[model samples]
Target: MLFENQRVTPSVSGAGEFMKAALEGAEAIVLAQSSMEELVKVHKICRRRPGMKLLLHLDSMKGLSKTPEAVSFLAGYIKPDALITSSPQAAVEARRHGITSVLRCFAFDEESIDSSLKLIERANPDYVQVVPGVIPVTIRLMRAKTGLPVLAGGLVRTDADVCRAEKAGATGITSSCPDLWQAAYVSRAKRS
Candidate 1:
């Protein structure tokens, strides 16, 4: 897995201590709920910190349109490693522009799971991020159905949760919890 070593990609709400902690041993970071007004600052931050992949959450990026042109603008100007969104249109556009696309799906029930799978098929995203990632069964089901790598996120507060998500076949875990961010990189031998 591309993200196996850096298992816990931190979802940042802003540029602060949490962001700094998240960058420690992490290969990627998700700019969670970033607004359009902050694009310049965010780009600068990611630029200064090379080697760490930056992912922008499109759904939460206020003023950003869900169009192919928008995706092109982001790719050409923002320069993020990837883009995450619940919109299938955005996912397609991201792929069209050669930026890695991640489909963010919420699986609360069987109906939602079915819908999410359909969306995944249509978008053909490079990866899928499942919210409320504690459900190991759902994680397995999603992986089997979509055949896309899963990045388990939401409510992942402990190291045990991280291990559980990985054991269930998640390529990696995403969390805003600083402590878990550090713990996710601990050597298995040391953890044991």
Candidate 2:
């Protein structure tokens, strides 16, 4: 339940996007495609919205070393609630620092899926994020193989895509589209 009851977590790269998502009622957000310099501004925005959960995507971040010390710094200083990374070492380090770790895997074909499963076993992360999440079969396969909550990301442009991912057993979906964010909140409100 990393995102709690929210099914869609906005993937944002800047302070503006973060603020907009927060205003749009996002409970959690993945900070991706961002730089080290932007952390301060994002952290300031986060402090204003203490209830929001922040996740830093290590691979997508610029000028941040993918090392244990870097993970420690992020956990201690930046204070993100979770860490998303493609590196097993980074994921392990995040867990060592008592931060939630999400292992990001790109599943383009059967070979990639098999390899990703092996990586997941070794990383032992808190969650697994499968890229190009439109593939329901891959989502189901990853969930079944890992026995961990799976987050579907990338190419999830429409509500139908979100529905497909959820029906396929995805615990949550991450998207950069603002329209999708509003749609998800509206859908959640309707359900409530």
Candidate 3:
């Protein structure tokens, strides 16, 4: 899985390294590709690669925010096991349509948080991810309200952040920073 800051240009070594970094220590992964075509390529690679669990995130980083073509591209490519989106409305629609949906609560402010919570409760996604900007209390409240798995994301630059979030009830973390997976794997091992 990629992050907001991860590189997305096509290159042999870069692609392999990206896959390796993203998949190596991840128990479950969410590939945030830049475009539909890139997403498809990642899916193919993930299908071929062993071990790491895969979740295709419909993160519209380099593409349109949310469009029919975007939705169709994601739905068609890879038959995603889980779909991630920032909009509660989209998440609800995805769930209504019977996909194992995941939502990223990109709550930059109180209003956004409220909106996201309303959406989360309304749609009841399989997972509700809180971006790194979201506070611990917000994560718990969202979990309590929606009764869904909570994943923390955004600006997670360190392992400590992952552990702290997990301790605070996050089910997982999303980050483009290369060190997170190894750090989290080690942390998970210690806890186990």
Per candidate, the number of residue pairs that clash is: 0, 0, 2
lDDT of 1: 0.78
Best by lDDT: 2
How does each model score on lDDT?
Answer: 0.78, 0.86, 0.58
TM values, all candidates: 0.88, 0.94, 0.74
Error of 2 at 95 (Å): 0.7
Q: Stretches of candidate 1 above 4 Å error?
A: 17-19, 183-192
Ranking by lDDT: 2, 1, 3
- Residue 143 in candidate 2, Cα distance off native in Å: 0.5
- Once fitted onto the true fold, the runs of candidate 3 whose alpha carbons sit more than 4 angstroms away are 1-14, 50-52, 61-65, 96-98, 183-187, 190-192
Of the two candidates 1 and 3, the one with more favorable TM-score, higher being better, is 1
Q: After superposition, how far is residue 145 of candidate 2 from its true place, in Å?
A: 0.8
Query: For candidate 2, what's the RMSD?
Result: 1.6
TM-score of decoy 3? 0.74
Candidate 2: C-alpha lDDT: 0.86
In candidate 3 the C-alpha lDDT for residue 54 amounts to 47
